[model samples]
Target: MIAPLRSKKIIVTRENAGGKIFSKKISQYGGIPIEVPLLRIDCDDRDENRRIMKQLDHFDWFIFTSANGVEYFFKLANKHQISHEILNAKNIAVVGEKTNQKLKKYGYSADFVPTVYDANTLSKEFLAKFQNPGEILLIRGNLSRDVLPSELKKANLSFTSLYVYKTTINFKSKNLLNEILQREFDFITFTSPSTIDAYFELSGYLVDKPCVCIGTTTENKAREKGFSTILTPKVFTVDAMIDIIIDYINKKEHI
Candidate 1:
């Protein structure tokens, strides 16, 4: 019986509010999960969030870029008693199916979602859908590096942004740093470039094992860190990463 994740110490580098859930998945997979939050969030413009929700009634469309953005936005809306009628009135747009699923969880459906996931694809789809250039409400987090909004502005679309949550780096996660240096896992998983950035910042250029990342950028980061056999699935999601890891394990078992 060849067990890939079974009883193996798997490194999970998910930070922020999602860290606990991330750890839970690692444990459920029969691996020793480490909970090390590499990022923390603080709402810098708390009042600005309310002000943005207050103006939801003014925009021609609403765009949600992340699942975190959706959760935080609704929390703020419910706090101020923002009615469902106001939420239901707009032409809604979302980045991916996950974002749309989250919206449906809150009793809303995204009228527009890009076929592919990511700001670049969403930006392209939005541009293709609307040519007249109207006002939009873009609800997002602290950092959005992808030039989606810039592309919209270039198309002459006016957007009011609601900054609900801001993410900050954690420089003092000694346990997380030590685990990587000690090489304490059979496998390590990275879901985003930010996860790679936060981890390498702590690990300081030490790599010698199997690693699985969800996308090309993360795979590049893994290669930059000297990981020889990095694995990447077609889609950048946790389930996809798990699937790829299982395939690798199955291949090894057959050999």
Candidate 2:
């Protein structure tokens, strides 16, 4: 039998390491992966972030929206010599399975994860679970959406945002993306809103190709950016995105 993604030229727009991992997975299924890393992720170790790390005990709940958030949060914690044990006193909530898994890597587990892995769902469910919850801390990147925090404010819940990392456009990848776009590709994958923004910024114009988004938020962003054909899996992961692409290809072949 042929590989599911055989001969498919798929554009991967994740950051460096993540793009490599995603490209390998695409190649595993016989896809020709074109890696155009659009976003650069770096730990933000500013004094304010360090100060927040030092006061981890003030929050009643800790919310992590992405794996990068979890990773950088713990990295800063370690840099400041903050004990991981301090997190045991707070309830940990994560947005996705990947974030939850990343948390586990630090010898911690999420106390809550929403049924649907999105900020809106997480906020709604979190509010539902803890009607009278105490102060919350949102561990996030620079470009994290305000949906969750806005929701918390609407419910009159107290929360503080701790930006643990910064995500910026990878200008070095612009020429590479332009060179790759000269050729024909089948599908493009976007993992986050920042990636989508970076693509438009670098590429100047959007390609008329089917786009696979990692989740509803990304899909919504793609739609807003005038991408007509968008595919999003129920599960918001790179693996889920690949599976959806395979299914889309299979269905197209049958038709």
Candidate 3:
């Protein structure tokens, strides 16, 4: 039987002091919300954005990795007075289902999205037809892995990256940490690698409580930061995390 979920608090450390949607979900599941933001965003460079948008016709695909990346890309495009038609390339790619919706908001549907959100899965699926493609314009944040770009190069497909934003530590959340650490929460959710980094920055040890992660990447980050046992949803998402956490609670009760 599933264990009762009541009076359990899970902290969602969103990058930009933004987790309203996540907080709502946790509350719906009987989990109290704690605000401990880990990172903040600032636009780093935009010069390369103009150069690419001006030559938009030269690109075969415009790929996005995050909702943040998609938001900033369109923001920059709109800022420079670039036409919406410039974004209609032969194809478009994104990392997650949510990011696909972000693209839809810009009036251009994404052509490719992974069933599961991750760099390896996204690249393998993209490369199937990417070998015959022309240059691709990969829009991402300041820091990201070279795995995707390197794979494209090996397949002889050219691609250029346009970093639209920067992710920096939110050194302003020290007061928030004191409140969070003083009170022990029932569950802690790690949504990104930076979130895990921020936890250690404040307290050397992770909380002695249940931990949930959105994806394997975040799961690994949590495990590295002294969280030995973490629950990673089979599907990487906030909704998926709920389903998995519910199931895990039941299984642990049986034991």
Q: Listing every candidate in turn, what is its Cα RMSD in Å to the true structure after a full C-alpha superposition?
A: 2.6, 1.1, 2.3
lDDT of 1 by residue, 1-255 (tens): 634456766677767567676667656665576666666666545876777777777898888988877887787777788886787778989988878888999999999988777787889888987886478888888775556778987888888888777766677775656656575567777766677777767766656667888677678878876779899987766667777877887788789
TM-score of each: 0.86, 0.97, 0.91
Best by lDDT: 2
Query: Would you list the C-alpha lDDT of every candidate in the order shown?
Result: 0.75, 0.93, 0.79
Q: By TM-score, how accurate is candidate 3?
A: 0.91
Model 2, 96-186: lDDT tens digits are 8889998999889999999999998999998998998898999999999999989999999888999999999999999999999899999
Q: What is candidate 3's lDDT per residue for 1-108, written digit by digit as tens?
A: 322456567787786434778887777777677867777877655676778778878888888988888888877877788778877645888998988887888787
Best by TM-score: 2
lDDT leaderboard ranking: 2, 3, 1
Alpha-carbon shift of residue 68 in model 3 (angstroms): 1.1
Ranking by TM-score: 2, 3, 1
